[model samples]
Each structure stands twice: as structure tokens, then as C-alpha cells.
Target chain A: MAEEMKVIYERPRSWANKVTHYCPGCTHGVAHRLVAELVDEMGLLDKTIAVWPVGCAVLGYEYFTFDSVEAAHGRAPAMATGIKVTNPDNFVFTYQGDGDLASIGMAEIVHAAARGWPITVIFINNGNYGMTGGQMAPTTLLGQKTTTSPLGRTPQTNGFPIRVAEMLAQLDGPAYIARVSLDSPVNIRKAKSAMRKAFNAQVRGIGFSMVECLSTCPTNWKLTPVESMERIRKEVMPYFPLGEFKVAQGVL
Target chain B: MSDKVLMKGAEALAEGAIQAGCRFYFGYPITPQNETPEYMSRRLPEVGGRFVQAESEVASINMVYGAACAGVRVMTSSSSPGISLMQEGISYISGSNVPCVVMNAMRGGPGLGNIAPAQADYFQAVKGGGNGDYKRIVLAPSSIQEGVDLFVDAFELADKYRMVVMVIVDGLIGQMMEPVEFKTKVDVSTLKTPEWATVGRHGRDHANVITSLTLDAAGLEKWNLKLQAKYAQVERSESRIEEYQMDDADYAIIAYGTMARIAKTTVRVARAKGIKLGLLRPITVWPFPAKQLQAYAPKLKGALTVELAYRQLFEDVQLALCGKIPLGWFGRGGGVVPGPQEILAAFEEQFGKGR
Candidate 1:
């Protein structure tokens, strides 16, 4: 008789079966997988409308098996609010990069959160603009060298790095605000859990929710995937601490 | 008999949008068009719709884009400078091939020129303001009644063509009060959702993705070809013009929007003086009633173009007439609106005293 075997793991149902365009060691694929997993686990595949930002994940819509719209650079939050408000019963979310959300789209993100629009945001902060090739971003660490900030970022010129999670947490609108890193297996699982909680806030119609994923851009960082993970632990984490910044009442 | 009520142009235009089944309105405040958002803020909730006062015109147009992608009737209104901020979002919406209505209540501008009425944005509206090879159906309304009436056509054309449809009115029309009637009331419940909307998959076999990005050069060229085809179809079928008193006329004045309304008085005055002057008003400025103007070129001895801005409308008139008739141009910029007598005097100066 043939041996009885069962599949232990496989791709998430909501994940599209296609090769990704992300550079090797980039955590955008990981972030996409987490979102896809949540879409499948929560049975929201059919009811999910994603607003993809104009950055590395600009074509993120192609990697997911759900309705999606592409927003102009930095306008994802506003676009997502438009979608959520008009289609109140549908689940809406925005996937953005640090440059897209924390820099050019600052006003959009702040206002969307302040309006308490019940939408989820998955922000991938890799310290620099990845798509445009290693330019300085609003979240670029101090002393980090980017093409735009070749020598190093300085307070007098380039300004200080923005801590978006802590800043948004101060607002009354957001029901949940959390920051997690994708530097390790344990933190990856934690990031997934935090994303679930953020989605729960929206599912329960509490208010706005966001999960900031401190990710890696190996190509831009000029480091191997392993060294990038280590840098997140020793460097990025000190500046952008990981933890839930806000959790509204009744959110698990 | 249709019930008519005295209404401010901006408020009437807002109510017209509501009547056309536009359930979502996103806008930021600006001069000559503030009443639109104010009216929508109060009236949308009553109609089971949504209204958002965005942080800026940039956000407002993006919100309009999002709602439009959800396959719903949505709109935004702004003045000159504010509309400039919306150009990027408008380009994205057009490139993505979604449907939405945008209103520009023209204010003077080279830069924050003034709050007074002006038509300097003619090139921006009928021509290109945003990036890429895109065209928006621009309807120029000469009166509050016409502005209200065009709102229905604006929304319908937007949906029909799956592109942006802009209704351009000057501050004069936007702020002035006139008797208007709500001629058409579209039942929002009857509006069918388009297949391309990104509202959610629901039970569909595949998800819809709305994007304007085509990275491949050949692929983008093919998309451009498709858009050009659609624009050609619109140009063939949608160009509109009103020929006022042109029969047996020796001279004509070509104008649009508020300028057209003021020029109508010039036509009457010139005819009273037996000058045989008439008016050719382009109702749809883009797709530009060029053919209609050409049809009159053979009969007209001279055509004078008048506007609230310098040489903008005259350029299109010149292109249409193509030097077949003696062309004359007159305009006042920086918020200066020429009176009927001044227009008549300019007409005589350009085309001579009488027929």
C-alpha cells in the first residue's frame, strides 16, 4: 500500500501564484505574504479592496487575489479612505512604503487617521526609498548613507528621522497602532499577530488601524539579507522601538 | 410646467450633482466655489450619501479617484490654483480609465491672480493641464440654468466614456443667482455598478485591478492607442455648439462660458445697429465644435473671438477657421470682464463699421 501523506503547509489561498519582482532579500515579499495570509485566515479574500502605493510595492495588486487600486505616490491613505467611506461594508486597506507614507503623504496619513476612517494601513519602513534606488527617506536613520544623503543624514540639513508610529499613536482616531520588525522568525510571527489585531480593529468598526513593519532593503542597504536583519536588531530598533503604541478598548 | 426656483449657481450645480446620483463628494475650500462643498456637506447625509472635507485639493482629488474606482458617481470642485493641485490625481484617474466629474469655477490666475471671474484656464481645460496624452470632456456653461443642466450630461458622459468629464464655469456664473429647475433626478438605487470597479471580488472568479502603470514601452503605446481611439469617438459624437442668430449674418463673435453670455448682448446690440453680427458659442470646448465653426467659415466675412483672457479662445477659433475668413481677437485678462458695449466697440474696430 502507498504511504499516506498530507500537506503540512502551502501558499495562502489569497496569494497569487506568480513570481515576485522584488529584489532578492527584500522583505516586501514577506510583508505581502503576511497580508495574504491574513486575508485567507480571516476569510476576507472576496471582500478585500487594497490600495497599493506607488513605490516598490506599486504592482502589489498583481500578487494578491483581491480587488485593488493603484494610488499615486503618497496618496494611498486618502484613496483608501475614499474606498472605505463609499463602500462602507467592504474591507479596505492601504499598503505603503516609508517614503510614500511618512514623507510625501504625511498630510494624507495624518488626516485619514484623525478622521478615524476605519481602514487598515500596512507601512513597510525600510529606511530609504527602495523603488527609486536608495534615496533618502523620511525614516532614514541618522548617520545612514543614502544616495541622496551620501555622506550621512544631518539634523541641520536632512532633518531628523520621523517616528510615525509614536506620532500617530498620539492621535485620538487610531484604535490600534503597532510597530514590529521582520528581522527574525519570532518577530515575523509577532508582526503577523499585530497585523491581525490591526485588521480586527477595522473589522470591529472601532476606528483607524496601522501596523508599521520595520523591514529590510538589502539591495539599497548594500548588505546581505543576514547583515540587514542584524542591522535591524542593533540599529533600526533603537530608533524605532517595536511594540503596540495604542490599542482601543475591546480589541483583542 | 417645471418648477423653477432662484438659486445661486454654485449651490445649483451641487444640487444638480446630487440629482445625477453622485453620492460621494470630496473637496477642499476655494473661492467662487465654496458653496458647492457647503451644500454637499448638509445635503449628502440626507440623501444617504457621503461628503468629505479633505485636507487639501491634492487629497480631495485622490479621494474622488478612490470613490470612482469603486464604480460610483463622485466629484470634486476647485478654483484655478486648487485645480492645479488636482492635475496629478486627474491624470491618474484618466490613465486608469475610471469615471468621475470635476468642476472648475475659474478664478483669475497666472498665479493667485484674483477671486473675480476669468476664463484664462481655457487652455488648461480644453488642452492638457496634467501629464500624459489624456483628454477630458470639457463642458462650458454660459448660465446657471445651463450649468445645472450640464451636470447630468457631465456624469452620464463620464460613465459612458469611462473618463473624466469637466464642467468649467467662471466665477460670474458660479456666484451669480438665477432661476433654475432640476430637470432630471436620477434614482441612485437604479445606478448599476460597473464590472471594472474595485469594490471587492465578492463571488467573482477573478479580482479587478485598476492601474495606469504600463512599464513596457510597447504596452504603454498600445494603451495610448486605445485611449486615442476612445477620444476620437468622443470627438466625433460629443462636440456641441450653439449658433445664435447666424442666419444671413456678415460677422460672428465666437466665445464660451461667461464670455459667451456677455457676447450674446453684443450680438443683440450689433444687430440693432444693423451690423449683421451673430454669436457662435462652443458648449463643449474640447472636441471643440471645430467642424461647426468650419461650416460657418464660408458664409462669414469676418469672425471676432472675445474672451476674459488673452488669445486663448482665439487660438482655437483660428485653428477652426484656418484663415478662410478674416479673424479678429479681443480679450481682457487679470479679472477684467469686458461689457457688451465694449465688446461691440471692439467688434467694429476689428471687423469694420457695418456689413
Candidate 2:
């Protein structure tokens, strides 16, 4: 008997029915899925406005079913601040990369967290600029080598890497700040949990919330997807340090 | 007519914006324009609107882009240096085709020039200071009253074209006080919300996505063409010029903003001396008043571009004339505001050179 297999798992309704443009083995797919699934589960798909930044996720609108806007390079925090302040009833979140949030957009992100704007920030730290072809990002480890840093980054030449979760946690404004990794299934589940907490923090109208996802970029790193996960687990996790930096009362 | 109340130009412009239904104001304080944000901070809360003093001009303009994308009337104000910081954000806003108003209370600058009145930013205002092919509808108001009145028109035109609109004034106008009557009450409910605005779906089939990135060259070309068509329509329907004593004159003085006010007095002085000079004040600087200036070009011997900058507005005057008539230029820069006497001397310089 030819029995039809029942569908146990499927795409979330909040995600578009199309192929994403992410590179092979890129964890942006995983991050996007977590966001879409949570948006659907929380019944915020209709009232959420995702502010995308100028990075690998610049075309995020194509994959999201809800309303989205594109911010200029590194200006997503400021844009999200405007959207959240004007439409207080709507949920606004900014999905940004290390280059977008911690580099040129440093001022915007700092001020947004300092102001305690009730918005969620999903920070993807891949250690290098993924869209611009493997340039050293602000989150690049001290000794990591990139296209721009062929001889490996030095403390004097490249400066110390910014720990965004820890930096933002110092501000009195943010309600929740956490750093999570996606190097394995256990960490992937933990990353999703952190994102859900960040989203709920916005829903509670507590303050700004951010989840720094230690993602992978096999194409930029010149490594296989398996090796990339190994790198995140071995190299990136030690430097980035996974844990909640700040948790507001009742936010989690 | 309503009773005119004494108001500073910046304060009057703020009132005008509020009346035009601008519910969100995000700005960083700069000299000569700080009063605008100060006024907004006090007034917006009364109307259940929001006012944010941003960290920098860069963040301020992005905030305007954010609020504007969510289908609200938003604005930001700054002086020349601060405005330069906002160009990148302005380019993004225009590229994304959002409606908002930016006010520049001009001061002299290639750098941090003094916080005095100057119209040196004419080129930056009209000639797409930011990267990419985009146009901003620029309105230059010479007086406090005119500046106040243009706010209503600026927001209306921004919504009508779904593009950026600027109300440009010099620092003098921003700081000076005058008895102004804001009689026009715009009913914002009558205006249609933009079809593309990102208002979260209460009950809609799809969501609105506002973005400027069109990676495909063909897709980007299509977007550029749409912007060009809309700009062409604006150029045809919204060109504004005020001709003073242009009917019987042998020479025309082309100016705008504070320069136009000085040119008015210059025209009177020159005409009293029977030099047969007239004034062509452009209210809409981007549209350039080219057609009206061309019509009077045949009757004039030559045109003189008198401005606060070295030769910014003169370039536009030359473009409009297209070498049909000889052009003369004179101006002051770096926070120097020329008087009617100084302008009259420049007119004599042009007349002397012609002979």
C-alpha cells in the first residue's frame, strides 16, 4: 500500500513561500526561521514591522510575510527607533549584522539602547563582513585573518573587537541583552529561546532588547559548513561568551 | 484674516508644520535652528505627537525616514553643517520614495562657518547633494511670514509627490521675529495616506515593504524612471516665481531667500537711478523658475545673479539662460550678508564691465 506521508513540520506562515538568497551553509536561514516561527506563534505577524539593514539581510523583505523597511547602511537602529516611537502599538525589530550594528552604525545602536526604545534587535555576528566579500568586521577575533587582514588581525592594527551584548548591557535602557551561538543543535535551540525572550520584552513595553546570534558564514570564512560550526564552537564562543548580559524583571 | 501674532521665524515654521499635521519631529540641535526642535518638544506633546532630540543629525534624519515610512508626517531641522551630515540619510529617503520635510536654516559654510545668515547652500539644496539620482522639492522663503506659509505648502507637496520637500531659510529669518498670521488650516483627514506606507496591517491582504535597494539593474532602472516621471510632473505643475517690476526693465537681478530681499531693495535703488533693473525671486529653487526667467530674458540686456554664496545660484541662472544673454555674478560668503548698497555696487560692477 502506497501510504502518503503526513507533514509533521512545515514552513511558518510568517515566512514567504520562496527560496532565500542566502549562501549555502549560511545560518541566516536558521535565524530567519526562528524569527518567522516566533512571529507566527506569538500572533505578531500582522502587527510586526521588520527593519532590515544594509548587509546580507538587505533583501529580507523578500522572505518575510510581514511589513518591512530597508534602512541605509548602519542606520537600522535609528530607523527602528523612529518606527517604534511613532507607531507605539506596533512591534518593531531590527535585524542587523556586526558591520551594520557595531561598525558604522555604532552611534545609532548605542543611542537606541541608551534611549531604551521599546524595540528588539537581532544581531548576527559572523566575525567578518559577509556581503562585502570577507572583510574584517568589528567583531572579528583579534588573531583571525580576513581578506583585508591577510596577515591576521593584530591588537595594534585592528583594535579590540567590540562585545556588543556586553556593551549594550552596560546601558540602563535595555531590558534584555543576551549572546547565543548556533554552532550545534543545542545552541540553536538556545538561540531561538533568547530571540523569543527578546521579542517578549518588546511586547511587555519594558525597554530595548537585543540577542546577539553567533552565526556562521562558510563562504566568507573559506571553510565547509561543518568546519564553520567547529570554528564557532571552538574559536568564536570563547571570545563572544554566551550568556544573558541583562534581564529585566519579568521580561524572561 | 486672523490676528497676526509676533513669532520668531523658527517658532512660526514649527507652528505651520503642526498645523499641516506633522505629528512626529526628530532633530538634533544646531545653532540658528535649535528653536525649531525646542518649539516642537513643547508643542508636539500637547497634540499627542512625538518629539525626539536625536544624538546627531545623522540619527535625526534616519529617525525621520523611520517615522515617515510608518505613514506619518515627520520633520527635522538643522543648519548648514548639520544638513551636510544629513545628506546620506536624505538620499536614502528619496531613494525609498518616502514623504517628509527637512528644514535648513542656512549659514555660511564649506566648513564650520559662523552661525550667521547666508544662502550658500543653494547648490547643496537643489543639485542632489547626496549620492544617487534624486530630487528634493526645495522652497526658499525670504520672510518669516513666507517661511511659515511655505510649511503648509511643503508638507502638502511632499505628500502629493511622495518625495522629500525642503523649506530653506537663512539664519536671519530663523532668528528674527515678525507678526505673522497662519490662516490656512489644512484638514489632514482629507488627504489620502500613501499606498506604499508601512502601516501595520489591521486588515489587509499583504504588508507594505519600503526599500530602496533594487539589485537588478533593470529593476533599478524601472525605479529611477518612475522617480524621473514624478519629478517631471512636479517640474511642470509646481514651478513658482515672484516677478517684481520685471515688465519694463533692461536688466534683471536673479536671487532668492535673503538675497531676494536685498535684491528688492537693490532693484528700487537701481530703478531710482534709472538703471532699469528688476527682481526675479524664485520661491521654488529646485524648479529654478527657468521658464519665467527665460521669458524676461529677451527684454533684458543681461542678468545678474546676486546671492550669499560665491557662485552657487549663478550656475542655475546660466543654465536657465543657456548663454542666450550675458550673465554677471556677485556675492559674499562665510557668513557675510550683503546689504542693498553692496548689491547696488555689484550691479554697477556689471554695468561697468558691459560698457
Candidate 3:
């Protein structure tokens, strides 16, 4: 008789065996694992409820073994509001992409933040709309080329990308709001830590906690994974600086 | 002991919610229904309940979504325009199968039509008000008393069916103040709730999965079957109707909400002139009290249906008859509530034509 050996980098217990449908080099796969690892670590494996908004991450329900609900396009915050308010005992969080949160869903997220709902939000701002194909996002960089902006995004006809973390940080309700990135190994570690801190904030009922990560999509960006990560480091971080934008005392 | 008070229909619903153990209300002010939230703001705190004025109807319904998940009876109110904005959230609640009340004191609209009473939302309300194949247990209340009692019933139905319950009324009911008796007072402290509530993992089982999506087709179909079964039970156990003056009647009138009360008055007036007319008023808009109407339909010469809107409720009455009896419909829209006098004239015309 033999017993299987335990492993660290093995698949997380809270995430299913479904191979991530994310394009190669898409950091959503990495981001998801980080969240699942934290849920497993904090013993919230049984009680965590994650909301997946309609975007590149709409299929997030398939990846997480923890219970997940898919909200309508731009309605994740509202859906999360329902779940969190009704079951405040469970750790509730929303995983939203750039367009889902910063653009069409701005009303929902802003209002949720203002109310100080005790929930966690992991926002992956990948600069362009991925699922609907390459399109300008609220976080899309100036002069970025996309299907919607063939020539390039111009200031007169198209608006500039939004800095969501810094904007939300100035609000009073969020206990923590940080800008993290996945462009490098050091930043990846920081991103996971920031996510853990946000979930921990929800655990303490401190208020809303959000970490907006600057991620990249190689398939949509028309680049290889290596090139995409490099572009994110050099191009995205210049506008959306990574740091702790706001924090409530004693939340961490 | 029932305590009596005179309150606006909108105000009555708010007070009834408080009495029904509701401690949180989130809503945006809209015409013909602003009193509900305004009252909650003043009264919820008195009862140690929470009342939040959301940024918009979209936010308000979501606020209720949050509060309802916390295991409390919660609600939001808006007129046509605001309610339209809330349709997406209402769909979310239905899909997730959350228990909460949404009061649409309907005003005229395909858009923001007017602040006056209208029954134009009947199709929207009884037909799930949003996407997905589901239905809200729609209760169309006719007066201030029904406004209060219907909300009480709505909460119970919401919890029972585990779906959204709509206290479907209009501006006329929302604004009119009438005497109402509170038959019961809710003490939330005495109630037991599902452990799935998101009140923070305290003394409970693992967090309940309160979502509507099951990506697997078979799983979603199974959930749908369960929901459909629950709705069937409501049709069997909770269907209601009020009949008036049907003895030896030759022609019957089918109506609901304010239109039914108005029809009752019309029947009484027509009775004085010696017309053998009856009234069939539906209480549960979805189950529709169809069998009762069908029973009357075969025996009567004809039936006339009335509503504030053109033809929504009339369709239901017709289906009830299943072509066993002749049916006629007359309604007005755009801020006008049908009066008994006009209805009486239509009844005479309908009766004569059928005879």
C-alpha cells in the first residue's frame, strides 16, 4: 500500500481541475491561484463566496471550487452587495476586469465603496477589453491601438484611461485601496500580499478593500507573453503607479 | 390585537414592513412612491432598523440585495421610471433566488410617462420583470389596508417561495390614505433564519451558496425545476379571489387591484338598476384565481375585464375562460384610473351584446 505525497505547487483544493481558458501569459490564471491560495490559507475555504463579473473573468465560476455567482455585465458590485449583505458571515469578494469595474460598472463600485460594505474586491485592470475582443477600456492607455481605436485613442474623441485605485483611495469608505502589478516577480509577491490584506480587512469588518492589479493580455494585445509582461512593466506602471493608496488603521 | 391607523398606501407598506420585522430599507425617491423611503428613513432608526437612501434605484435595489442577504426582510420602492432602472437588480434577485420585496407604485410609462396611477407594469411584474424564466409572486393591492397587508403577505411569500415578491400597486394607492389595521407585529428577534445569510460567519454552518448561476446545464435545469415546483405550490396553496354579488348573475366582471374595487362599486350601481352582474377580483396576480373565474365564466352570459392599462390583465381572464365564455376588455392609460361610472356603462353594453 502507498499514499500520495502532498505538494505545494499542486492544484489548490478550492479551485477545480478545469484548465484556465485564459490566453497564454494572461495573468488572470496566476491572480486566481493567489486568491484561492489565500482562501485555503485563512481557513475560509468553506465559507468564501466569490462573485465573477461578465468580462474576461466571467468563466471564473468554473475555476474556483468555492461557490461563485456570475453577475450581469457591470453588475458585480450590486450582486456582491446582495450576497454580502444577506450572508455577512461568509467572506465575499468580486473579481472584476477593467471594463466590468472601471467603465460601465463604475456606478456600482463607487456606491459600494461609499457605503463601506464589508466585502473584498480584486480588480484586474488589463488595459483593454479582452473577452469582447480588443477594445478601449476605461483603463486603456493613451494612444493604445485596439479594434475600436484603430488609429489610436485620441484625447478629443476618446477619453484617457482612468486611474481606479488612486480614485477609489480618496473615498472614505474603503478600509484599504492599493495598486498592485503582475509585471514582475517582486510585484507578483506584492499583489498576493495586497489581496490577502484586502480579504483580511473584510474578515475584520473594517470596510471595503480593493486591490487593482495592472495585468496584461497577450492574445488581445497582439504580443507574446514575454513581450506583454515587459510592455506592462514599461508602459502601464508609468501612469498607474503601484503602492498602497489608502489604508484604514488596524485593518491589516 | 390589531392596531388601527390611517396611512397612505405607500406609508402603510413602509409601516407594515417595519411591523413585519423589516429592519433595513434602501430606496430612491420616485414620484407616487417617495413616501415609502421617506417614512423608512424616519422610522427604521426608531426601531433600530437601517434605512439608506441609495444614489439611484439601481443602487437602492442592490442595497436591499445586500440587506436581504443579511437575513432580514428588506425592500425598495420606486415608480415606473426608477423601477425600470432597478429591473436589472430585480432580475439578479430572482436569479439568485433571494427573498425581498420590491414595491413598484407604477406610474405611466414605456419611459417616464407620468406620476399618476397606471397599471401598465402588470405584464412586467407578473412576467418576472426582468430576464430569465421566472416569476415574482405579484400581489396587486387595491387600497391602503391591502397595501399594508399585501407587503406582509409579500414577505411571507418571498421567504416561502424563496423568490422576489412584488407588491404591485400604482400612484393612486401609494398616495391615498385610508384606515388600516395592523393584524400582526413582526419581532425579528423571535424568528429563525437560514444559516446561508451573509451576516458574517458567527454561529452557523459553512456559508450558504446564494447564487443563481450553475454553469452546468443540468444543474441549472434542476434548480429551475425546483423553483417551478415552489411556484406551483403557491398556485395551489395561496391563490385568492374576492367575489361580489354573483347569485343568479348573467354577466360577470373580472378585475384586480384598484380596478376590481372600482368594478365592485360599478356592480353595486348596476344592481340597483336590476342588472344581474357579478365581480371576480384576483388577489394573487400570478396564480390568477383562474379556476374561480372559469367557474363563473361557463355559467355567465359574458365577462368584462377592466384595468388601468389597455390589455394585460384581460389576457389572463381570457385564458381562464379557455373560450368557454365570451369576454370583453375596456381600459384607459396615461394617468387615468377607470371610474365605476364608465365601467357600469361598459358592463351594460357588454351584457346587452352577449344576450
Candidate 4:
């Protein structure tokens, strides 16, 4: 008996053939690959500009094969707004982390969404501040222990984790908003679907679209890669409910 | 012949930027400079340009940063506190070598001192306000007409050097009305967009990456040295100063911006009293006219550096003269404008041999 097999899956043409700087047990690599694959599928490599954030992705331009610019801490949304407004024909998006977008950049992202800016935002919500030594971030769970919250986050001291997708969906301007997680194969496939939908909304000239990915930082969370994925499924998924919150009336 | 139009300093500067081919403006409303964004909002749309009233000053400067990297002439105007908020973004822009124009309609400071006219931010303007070894091509305009002219020149200088160019004026100039002549307009077609701009991948073979993070120490050093070389060239080629009635004079007053206007009056009163006095007004403060001042150092008995802040500009004058000529300083602060009589009295107290 003879068997024949064909190779179908490979790296996207939009991604540079190089190693990432993210630590082991980190899901940023997966997020990056998904973006590259989607951008390649949509053929947006030639007319896309990515705004990098000040967190671990400060050197993100090195991994992407498209035009990119680095923004100061918490300023990516503002920079993205300007780029989209000035170059409306090009595809523009901002890659930001919870600390960069939710903590210091709250105003920038909120206003950009409210203005109905035609751009995409890929918000990575990894409960802890992974870049700065496992510090407490705006998305940290209620009882999660971080460097800044050593005694474990208490309601009296640290407030509840921010539900970004829900908050942004409340704004009347966004065309599509969804929260997804990368905890398991089933969730990951769903995450890709949500991302693809968000990118499609942007391509169709729909107003601001955002995809919030619940990612895992095992090293920072002090867990194995397997355990971290389980944590995202059990702990982070409950508070940050997944699914589409706002799909513009006609944008589906 | 050109027509003279009566306009506020803010509006004149806005019109001048348009003539200079500036196509994008991002600003937040602040006193003494609110009219600038207002003027741009109404005029930019007519010319196919863009304007955005940003969420905050921090957001506005970052917007300018993005537009600048996209290969467009952009600007943002603010006051003292707002400019302070923009320092971090300005540092990023300077480090990336993105060409843009920023105008600071300075009001009283040291912490929201007042809304009145003051030169308290002279040090923050000429020196590097943000972290890094960088300098802004600071232009100080004493009159509304001069502000318009300087605004036009700022765009060219920023493009040619690929750095931030600043026009620092007091609240008085921003709010006051004066007749200004619009005689010149730089050809927008002649301006070159560098190969590094992120205007898409149509013409270039590779994607452009605009960033300031040089993680390697040696790499960062090389960039800093390149910036220093450009600054050296600017110093040699762009130093500008106006010397008034310096012929056969013994006492000279070194001033700039609104202080220069007051010093002009001081020169008149001192000369009327039979004292040989003159004025040296610096138009470009960063590439300071130190060479011109040095040329007159031997001829003058002494010099008085006048400013709204206490001894801020005096530090620069001293550095330029380096003790070869004795320098005296006098001024008022916290939005207080020194009177001509008060300045004349200070000049006599310091340089007067009989008094």
C-alpha cells in the first residue's frame, strides 16, 4: 500500500523568518502568527502600517514585514488615529498590551473608538504585566498575586479587572468588537475566526473594530505553559466573557 | 507688492504654515493658543488638509508624530503646561528625526503661573525639555509680523534638517492684533519626502520602519553622533540676529522675543540721555547669534541681558561672552512685563559709570 501527503500549512509571507524575543510559555508568538496569516490572506501587506506599543512589543517592527512605527508608552492609539486620518487609503492598526492600552492609554483608545476611526486594534490581555516583571496590570484577576500585589489582589486595595471589550462596546462608534481567548484548540480556532472577522470589518471600511485576546504569560504567572492555558480557561475566561459585543447594525 | 492684513498672531502663524505647505494639524485647546486650532480647523478642510482636536496635549503631539512619519508637514500648538505634557512625545519625535513644527504660545509658568504674557519658558524652549541629548531649532519672534515670517521659515528648516523646529512667543504676541505682510510662499512641490517615510510600499522595494529604539549602545551612539553633526551644520549656517544702532555704541542690550521689544524701547531712552546704547535682538535662539554678540563684545563697555524670567537668558549670554565682557541681567517674572522706564533704570545702574 502507498500513501501520499501534501504540505499545506506554512509561515505567512508577511512574517519575517526570524526568532521572536518573547520568553518561553508566552502566547505572543501565536498572536503574532495569527495576525501575519490574516494580513497575508487578505493581501494587505503592501498597504498596511502597524503601530507598535511600548511594552514587550516595542521591537515588534522587526518581526513584521510591513511598514511600522513605534509609539511611546500608551500613545499607540493616538498615533494610529493620526496615521489613519492622514493615509486613509492604507490599512492601519495598533498592537497594544493591557498595560499600554488599559492603564495609561485609556483616553487615547476611548476617544479613537468614539470618533469612529476606520482602524483595527489588537488588544492583548495577559492578566499580569509580563514585560515589567510580573507586575499587577489593569486586567489582573481579583485574587491574582503579582509583584505589586504580593498579598494577592483585594477588593479594598486593587479594583476589579477591567472588561475592555464590554467597555468599548458601550461606545456607539465601533463597528465590531469581540473578546476571545487562546486557552484551548477550540477557543484558539474561535479566536482566529473573531480576528478574521475584525480584519474583514476593517477591509470593508467599517468604523473602529477591536479584538481582545485573553493570552497567557506562564513565566510571569509562575505556571507551566499547560497550567497557564488552564488558568486562562478557568480564571480569566469567566470575568472577561468571550464573544462579539458589538457588530455594527449592517457590518455582519 | 503684498497686501498687509490685520490679524492676531495665532491666525497669522496658521496662515503662514498653510502657505508653507503644512497639510496636517493636531492640537488641544489651551489659552493664548486656542485661536490657532480654531483657525486651522476652519481653513485646513478647505485646502484638502486634515485637522483634529485631540483628546489631550499628550495625544495631540503623538498625532503629530504619526503624521510626520507618514511624510507630511504637520504641527501642534500649546501653552506652557501643555507643552510640558508634550515633552515626552517631542523627545520621541526628535529621536526619530521626524520633521515637524511646534509653536509654544508661552504663558506664565513654574506651575500654571498665570495666563498673562511671560517668557518664563525660555529655558525649556532653548534647552532640551525632554530626556535626551537633543535641541529644537528655536525661533523667537518679537513682533506679530516676525512671528508669521518665522513660522514660514520653520517648516523649511524642519524639512531640510529632519528635526523639530519651534516658534516660542509670549501670550502677548499670540493674543495681540497687528498688520502682517504675506509676501513669500515656499513651493510645496520642491519639498522632498525622504525614503524612510511610511507612505505605503508602492515605490520602495522594502517596508520602512520608523523607530527610535536603538537597543545596542554602540548603535545609539552612532545615531547621537549623526544628530550632533547636523546640529553643528545648523549652528554655522542658520545663526540669525538683528543689530540695531550698534555703530559707535558703548552699551548694548542682548534680548529676544518680547524682551527684545522692550529692549528696543530701552535703547531709545538710553540714547536720548546721551548714552551710547544699542540693541542686539536674537531671532534664532538655539543657533544663538553668539558669534555676532562676540563680534560686538570688545566694542561695548558692558551688556544687559533682559528677559521675563530671572537670569535665564543671561546664562546663555554669559556662556557666549565667557567673561570677556561683563554681563548684567534684569527682568520681571510671573507674567509681569518690565516697563521701558524700569529697563532703562536697570541699564544705567549696571553700565552707567556715573551712577
3 against 4, candidate with superior TM-score: 4
Q: Which candidate comes out best when scored by lDDT?
A: 1
**How well does candidate 1 reproduce the true complex, by DockQ?**
0.92
Global CA lDDT computed for model 2: 0.91
Recovery fraction of native interface contacts for candidate 1: 0.90
Question: Could you tell me how far off, in angstroms, the CA of residue A107 lies in candidate 4 after the best superposition?
Answer: 1.0
Q: How many residue pairs clash in each candidate?
A: 0, 0, 17, 0
Please provide, for model 1 over A1-252, each residue's C-alpha lDDT reduced to its tens digit, 9 standing for 90 to 100: 789779786899999989999999889999999999999999999999999998999999999999999999999999998899889888999999999999999999999999987899999999999999999999999999999999999998899999999999999999999999999999999999999999989988999999999999999999999999999999999999999999999776
What is the C-alpha DockQ of each candidate? 0.92, 0.82, 0.37, 0.78
| lDDT of candidate 4 over A28-103, digit per residue (tens) | 8888888999889989998899999989888889998899999999999899988888899888989999999999
Please report how far candidate 4 places residue B2 from its true position, in Å. 2.3
lDDT of each: 0.94, 0.91, 0.82, 0.89
lDDT for residue B282 in candidate 4, whole number 0-100? 91
Model 4 alpha-carbon drift over 4 Å, by segment: A1-5, B187-190, B353-355
lDDT of 4 at B44: 92
Which is better, 1 or 4, measured by TM-score? 1
Error of 4 at B101 (Å): 0.6
Q: For model 2, name the residue pairs that clash.
A: none
The regions of model 2 sitting more than 4 angstroms off are A1-8, B189-192, B352-355
lDDT of 1: 0.94
CAPRI quality level assigned to candidate 3 from its DockQ score: acceptable
Docking class of 1: high
